[model samples]
Target: GQVEGGRKISSNTEASGRFHTDWLNMIYPRLKLARNLLHSDGVILVSCDDGEVANLRAILNDIFGEENFVAQFVWKARQFTDARANTNISTDHEYIVAYARDDGFSLKGVGRDESKFGNPDGDPRGDWMSRSMLGLATRDQRPNLHYDVVDPLTGRVFPPNASTGWRYSKDKMAELISEGKVLFPRNDDGRPREKKFRSEMRSEFIAFRSIIDGVHTADGTQEIRSLFGVDLFAFPKPTALIASLIEQVAADGDIVLDFFAGSGTTGHALLKQNAAENLKRRYVLVQLPEPLDPSNREQKVASDFCDKLGKPRTIAELTKERLRRSAARIDEENPLFKGDFGFRVFKLASSNIRAWEPVAADLESSLLKNAEHLVQGRKEQDVLYELLLKLGLDLCVPIETKSIAGKSVNSIGGGALIVCLADGLSKDVVERLASGIVTWRTALAPAVDTRVVFKDSGFADDVAKTNMAAILSQNGITDVRSL
Candidate 1:
């Protein structure tokens, strides 16, 4: 369900004079929560266009600390020209704002793509790569790096370029020569350079600037169209771009969450990267279940496209279908690459139980109406999920429900969450709940010091609250929260 005034207040309309302040406040809390959710070494990459990039950066600096700011990646989203537009400048790029959880967080030792390494000359050490030995500094600026490189085969020495200097000092060059890292050209006419063995290089390194080229936006679109025979999404980012970002920020087994899962492209990218690297990276994608608009021609095209591919009509349907196809492709290309594309689905809804009150003549009808309002259109399971999110619990936490004293008492995350979705929480129910805490602690084998959280509205009387608290305190339940 959408929060009505919540949106207006969050977006900060003209009615809210402190629009900028409101916007920052709205995002600040979420970021703070996100920071808590992330691992100590985790990094967050937030994608935004020019519209709010500046504001996002400033707020990120304030929230995550200026020292934790990572590189801002600039991505080219499109290649087509828009000269027909009134504005002379055509915007086709976007930014990915990156920040670390702490100063210790770094991107070093991340795996690099094997395709980037190649060996023209077969070396004993295996695939070797050549890199320029010239530094960007001018010879005049860095005289220490300016030196002559002698071709031992031709007995000739070459002077450093006037514009650029050698990358190493004379002593360092001599050390590299003794170590056999410097490669003299076979022709004896070309400049000498340094050789980097693939085996010697670190598997991971810091990510470069965000400006990505070479991979076309059309490449992603074509990949989807090739599988489905028509554009499944308006614009999808190339797998390479997403893979690069993932490799730089995410660890092998970390869970990546994408709440704005448009067309499920991020899932596909994650799966592809994991398969290629033999890493097990799990992904959770959340998308609004927006229905297809039949009257729109674009919708018609998508519908016909799905028909052509012998698939379902809706976007979510096609998203799963594409994931299956990608998994199949990975399996075909590399038998060793095991692809996992399974996911559990969930939907949000309201609470299941009602706040109890006495059924007196003045309150009877209101109590009945409120009970109906609580459980009429929503399921108990959906309410439980909503509470979990509201309580800042991980979505993947396990939940177990059992009938206790004719009421559904849910033990979530091993009794960290104790919920009762019953019509009226009576004195007997509270007593049972208090006893169940001990049962759950034993069942889950958690430390005797486990916390318990209950719905504030579940208590029927002051005695029930006192008994529950006293029982919990006796059992060493030191932490408790209500919602």
Candidate 2:
């Protein structure tokens, strides 16, 4: 549902519950991070029950701002039992709160079925539909709509009902009549209607259903049961529901990020939906490998399931397994699908740069070891990805490398970032390499400023490093740094 007036209103959370203050504290910064990660047109949906819904909304308001509050979707799931609650009423419904990153956020509207529209009159424009031109408000509510529409051809006046007046003002009615798009009835009692043309429809699609219907919490458990042959995760969000949400906000080529990747339903749904529709929607799912103990009642099934699959016993492990199984299922169902769905897992690690830990007795030796810069067994790809994270470049951004003076130089983000981590750069090759980079940068013509990074230890001596920086600086490529 759309926010009323699309206006910024001050959120009144003074009376919100304090029971979940600790939960709110942890989620506040994460919401801010999610906002920063969103695309220009991206949106976020958070799920909660009645107990903490108000508190969750309050923090979401504080982080995303009250103005960006989009909707609070009601997922009406039938509660088989709510015996734990002391209240008289059973809590059968849950809420999914949504917020936009900016003003550009909008859900994809559903298109109107054209079967109802036809060119019965055969107008030159296109198929036309006659619609009632009556306003929903009373004469008191909209005084302007309570006006007379005179048929000039017959010179007869038709007055609107006081309870429901004409849809448009007198001036607009006159304009429509002049344009021959208004239908005046011959009978004195019949109301006038609008000749809306198929070609002139304001928009092709209408608002999608606001209420979540049919789907239930049991459906989620059943879906996992169907896939795993046992209920591995309890109350997992249904892939169908997540797919519907993804379809509404994310178009082709859009990215969906789920920081709390529970069961990887978001990724699973995105993959299945995108493959079915041949869309290029991508996703980034961040799930911590929370340890799961097989002996623990809550996690026993999932942890045992992970063990049977010969994987680590963690929620994140199962999340990845869910995605893999979902993709394999999609491939089996659609053998000719061109296999456009897949994901790579990247683990969080410390920076590849070797830190210098100097003891007073071993200061000189520590300096010598630090001279190497990169840690032992660290690959170039690891360092390259670390550079991407530090630079805030998209991890999926295009990266290409070229041989310059027998050394591989990498170009990233269409040359916005240039890197050369090759070792053993001599003064003789520095000029040639720098010159080649300058020539390539000219060809790239990136829309933004370029930053060049090199391995500090790669240079043979200080003179080689100075010469490389000097050559790049002289050619309007001054932003240079060493690893």
Candidate 3:
């Protein structure tokens, strides 16, 4: 659903717009809500094309704070040849904005692929990769970094280049020599230069730049065609492209969500990443169940293909099918990845219970029209999920729902939280709730804090609130709030 307080004003022919201040107003609340959903050490990755990149970045900087910005990744989606000849500029890349929930969030360093590291010499120190040791400093700029390199085998001193100096001082070279980190490269004339083994390198590597150009749009298109045996979608991102970002930013067992789950590409990428690295990362994908235009030729082709394959015709159906196939592929490739994909389905709908209608006909109609504002098209469970997002609680956290006094009460994290969404709470119910608090106090483990959240409309009167408060005070339950 479109978030409130934002106007969809058209600006360009392609349905783009210059968002008004209300757009920022709309985004702020969602960003704030999203921030509350993240773990203290979690991060959020937001993707945007050129249309809203600047505005999104500015909004994020304001909401998440400038210091929390991790990086803006630029993914080149198309080839240079795809550039428009008239403009002489290729608009092929999209930006993914990243921000940490807090200063504590950080990426685990990228590990070197074992296949990429190899040692030709077969030294006992294990596989190695050669890297340049050249320094940018000139002799004039850094005399301390300039020195002669002695060929350990030939005893010939190689002077520094006139323009550039050595990377280390004489004393540092001596220390490296003593530690056996430097290798003397042999030449035809029996002279040698220094070689550093990969074993001496740090276990983790630093994060790379944000620009990515290896995966092309053709790669993405080809991947979809090969996996599904048809080109059903346009401009799908390559699984590798998304995997690279996930691997760089997310950790094992982390939750990665993509609200604009176009073609289920993100889910495919997450599955592939987990299979390749033996990680246990989870994913949440959301997409509008936009209906396909059956009259269109391309849509007809897609429909026919799905019919032939005994699949459903809607976009959501196709999206789920893609995920199913991706999961199957992972399972086929590695049994360890089997049964690793599952999702809880939730669809937005009007609340199951109706609110009280006013006695007057016109007033009742108005109330019904504005019902969406007072009551959401969501259930208590849905509200709880949103609250969890707002509170930064993990989706996997255990939630127990019990029917206490004919009310569906939810307790999360082993009584750490008690939520009552029941409407029309009476004094008798409030007294029972107070008694329930005492029972919960005894049942809850020692030193574990408990909190209760109630709907403001639930209580019948102030006397009920007073009674509840007095009971909670007696039971040492201070954390309570009314929504």
Candidate 4:
């Protein structure tokens, strides 16, 4: 049932065997792209039920490597009593498999459990908690750490045992004692403890455990129901569960991505989390525009929603609608906690530029006619984005349009790069534009690798084209080119 709506094709492969191969074929390229998209210090958490956990792990291991496997968090997806009708056992849990880009990764802990931390002694350093100073290393393993320490306050000596040695060396112990960071008990028989101050703690990170419970499927279902007045999605993940995973690995203002964004749950959770933490975390969600089959009972409500909203009957349309309603609801409920709950939507499409392909019979005629390169009817924004891809620049960079010499120019990354594809470029306009961009470069970015690009065939004549290049080169901005 889970794989019912999958794309079908006639093949010699067995039905069950085809499923695995097809699924992996779809996922493999996406995984490769996701890895490239992530920052080097970033981590990814993927949720899956028991149905494909084994296969998923093997694929992850092959892609991210076995060493980069961070943890497998087992979440209670459903209650024990939520049994499947045909199966003898109920599937009550799911896995959140995590992997880092490399060995360099650490999760920020769930903020210190304040219930266990307090200034019991009222030490000026701050609220402190005590931990055992003894480590599991034996005296033979670390003889330097097998030392005795005298508590300055209690005048009591603590010695390392045969099985466990003192955690710190004599010099380190003395340093801790001088800083009043070591807790000395009144009873001389007690072992000396290390005081970890809330302020001085190097990192507020705890190793995320492998098992996560209590976040149930009911919460996720309730979330969708609350927004849409009905359960439009099947087995949507809990917002809290996703938020917790995100908070562990991501920092404020980091980009969160979800490719399988059913019902836009990830976006909803990000908005709620950002509102709570006063963060500017952004999200990138990708959901296929799968057409809803009204014949299927599960998607009937969603299909009806599409009709009600007067939108196309597609999953992506519903996903976007959910995000819109969720953001509006959050704003209404928490007016004071204002943060960006908005997203700019972009659809994937073929390049706006026509690829140069010579016709065998009329190669010369075709080449001359399509010299402009860009396809007809392509919007300015489309051309800009295509150029961004060609230049290896981030498509989402802040773009600002400025009128230079009466022609519109697009400045990206705060004047780090400027593009002018307007037609009919004259020598006078070219000179004025070059001077204006130089001024902008000095004021905005200043020696920050400014580059200027133009339409190759748009120049009025050879004199204008040569003048444009000479003017830019004279102004200490030689990185000029034309498409």
Candidate 5:
């Protein structure tokens, strides 16, 4: 893959309409997959400039439906200046099109401004803020809630105003007064206010705003400069920008995914947020190995950085390095943070197990030569990861390796899946492996069914293989198979 470098986008018919359609064509399938990955309440935010904002919105609406479309946040990504010199209008803002998987999607609100809250009365309930208890509706609309207030200390009764009504019913108001939640006015005629304790308040969240400002492109550049001591990326996303979006939907220990992880900014932001909040959140980043051209001014810095680190001059390499640097910095900055900042690297490619579709003429020869279905030059670990894919397990799930009966066995997802790629399994080894699996299974206690897999050819004979499966089955491990 090669970087388009903004050359593919233009106002012309060839680039504007056709190019955007092409972009949507590429994104349509990915959007369907992303929807499947999302939780019922999960949200997905896609950032794009003005070029394809309308098209992006249309595609999202078609995929997620109009009802699931949340909001289009206008982010001030840059200062009030035109990106291109010829354009008179300043296209300084970008749009983040958000969509939810279902109606359960709810964004966590920003905490209330604590500065506005205080304990003026020194109430035992701690800090609180006073608010008028008057209802917004007219007295005619809510006749039942239009009752008057009575001040016990003042021994005076105050009637509701002709326009507005009391917020609570007479019985509820009496209960509030009994609980000291209603504030009595010093003057007999003064209006009684309600005491809203910070500890007891339910609606403390400030509503999310559709406009995001303050963070700009310059800030993003400065962030990279601070981290790498040089501008490695010309337009890295601001950590705060992505972190804010993540906080709105993602909770502690949730996984955040970024398929086009340019410079790994999304991963860096997730790590920073986890460190700041003392939470453990994981990230999955995918980037193409789009080579950096030395002739391009924007990519020269990245190219030099690659040369300095003795790594490949590609966007993928830079992305990984950025994550490593960001994690190291976070650990150094916050030594007390115990969250995991490590990420597993996975490359998308064809499976390690060979697929056979031999012709009738060559079928016999193919079977004789390729008795072992496993592909050549593939490592045991490679085969293990391929099994994880075939079994539809998350790649990021923890994988533990142990020596069971002198054979290396991999325990994945906390013993939910036990895979042994060892060769020449004997009766004693089978019994030992089964015992170890049962012990680990009991200790780990995976919520799902535990499964065991072995290389079909690795066994000494059919008897050993059958014996292993039978031993595991006798120990209540029914799900067992071979590669």
Candidate 6:
């Protein structure tokens, strides 16, 4: 969507107070949160065009300090000429503004060309490259580097140029000559070069270019057409662009998170990249289930597609379906591959625990409704995941269950979160359940202390709840809670 009020030059707003406020107000908080979420070495890239590139740079300069500014990469998104141009002009490029979290951050640059350095002279140190020894300094800046350089073998003096002085001082130049690191020319007026050994180089990679090309938006359209046999998204990013970014920053086992996962291109990119490189990388994509409207020109086909599939008319449903097809395509292509191709969907909703809402007029009915702490018709797995969230466990954490004393118990993240949300908890089974949990906790031996939770209303009586807590506490599992 376009900016609500366009870019306002003035900071002050009109009486109605809507002067280019919608876009800025929406992006400012999200950028702040993204900065807070980034690790010290992590980078945040925001894609924009001529509309808000200046405003984005200004705000980013304020959030991530100017020193942390990485690069403003230009992606050539369009390959073909614009034939339907009203103004006889075409904008075929977009800016990806990147900023690092700290000054220490740097990209994993492109691979180095080792072929450029070879031991042709047989100096015995290693492969070396001849580099110019001229320095970008005037005689006034460094008086020591302006002196004449003598070729010890030729017995000839070579005066350093006033504009481009010698890179090293007189003492360093003499040391290099003694160490045979300075290369001399056979001609009379030729300046010397430095022998830079490959072993002494600090980095193996050279700097990456700021301009990106070859990958185009047309590739993304073709991908959608191949996967779904229809162009569902009007403007989807090509996987090649995202795959390039991933290769520059991410490594094996790294998590690639996309907050606005339109059409789930990032996931598709990471999956194909991992399969091609034989790596273990994962992705987390977050997209809203906003209902698509058939009236909209761009979303009409997508909404109709969802109708044909008997799914909800939402962008998120299409994203899920795309991922499903993407995973199946990978499996079909790579039959021998044995990596994770799992995709799971989760939505934001009310908690499974029923909060007590008391009505002053109907106290008796409130008590009856509040008798059960857990909500009615909630699945056991749903309640267990709720406990996992409350206990600060990963949503994708491993969950294992066991039948303890004829009751269902779940252990999450090994034993970081142990929960028993089962029904029919009585005094007779309290000791047996506690002992089973203790045994499991001992065997798992999680890094952190164990947190056990139970269904508060599942106890037959008050004495049974007390006994359950007491047995667990005696066994050293003190941190316990209930739904």
Best by the TM-score measure: 5
What TM-score against the true fold does each predicted structure earn? 0.66, 0.70, 0.66, 0.75, 0.78, 0.77
Better of 2 and 4 by TM-score: 4
Report the C-alpha lDDT of model 2 over 81-161, residue by residue, as the tens digit.
667778867788889899998876778887788886888777888888888998888988999989888898998888888
Candidate 2: RMSD over Cα atoms? 8.4
Per residue, candidate 3 scores C-alpha lDDT tens digits across 326-435 of 88877888886543766666666654444666657588687767544435555677777766666687666778777767777887888877788887678898878678
Q: Candidate 5 at 118: error in angstroms?
A: 2.0
Q: Highest lDDT, which number?
A: 6
lDDT ranking, best first:
6, 2, 5, 4, 3, 1
lDDT of 1: 0.73
Name the regions of candidate 4 deviating beyond 4 angstroms.
1-17, 118-205, 329-339, 359-362, 402-407, 426-449, 467-478
What is the per-residue lDDT of model 4 for residues 1-483, given as tens digits with 9 covering 90 to 100? 124446433222444667667777767778888888889998878887776789889998988889999888899888557555577776678899999988878778666676667997777877888888987788788889888888776566777877888888889989999988887777766778888877777766666777888888889999889888988888888899888887887788899999888788899888888887888888999987778988899889889989999999999998999899989988888899878776767878788878888889998899897877888888777888888888898767788898988888989999878899888898878888888878877778734778888888779999999999998888788999887
Clashes of 3: 1
Give the poorly placed runs of model 2, Cα more than 4 Å off: 1-18, 79-88, 120-125, 129-135, 138-140, 143-195, 356-362, 369-372, 376-381, 390-394, 397-483
Model 3: residues with Cα > 4 Å off, grouped in runs: 1-30, 113-130, 178-180, 188-194, 197-199, 294-314, 353-483
Which candidate, 1 or 6, would have the higher lDDT against the true structure?
A: 6
| Pairs that collide, model 6 | none
lDDT of 3 at 369: 73
Native RMSD of candidate 5 (Å): 5.9
Q: Deviation in angstroms for 215 in model 6?
A: 2.2
Q: Which rank order by TM-score, best down to worst?
A: 5, 6, 4, 2, 3, 1
After superposing candidate 5 on the true structure, give the runs of residues whose Cα lies further than 4 Å from its correct spot.
Answer: 1-17, 80-84, 121-202, 403-406, 414-416, 424-450, 463-479
Tens digits of per-residue lDDT for model 5 on 1-483?
222564332223553557776787667888989999987878899998887888888888888888998889999988657668675777778888999998767689898989978987777889988889888778679888888687877668888877778888899999999999998777766788989888887876978899999888888889889878998887778999999888888998788889789988899999889988898878888787777888999889889889999998888998898899899999999999988878778777788878886778988898977688888888898998888888899887899888878889888999899999988787777888878878878888999889998999888888888888888888899999998
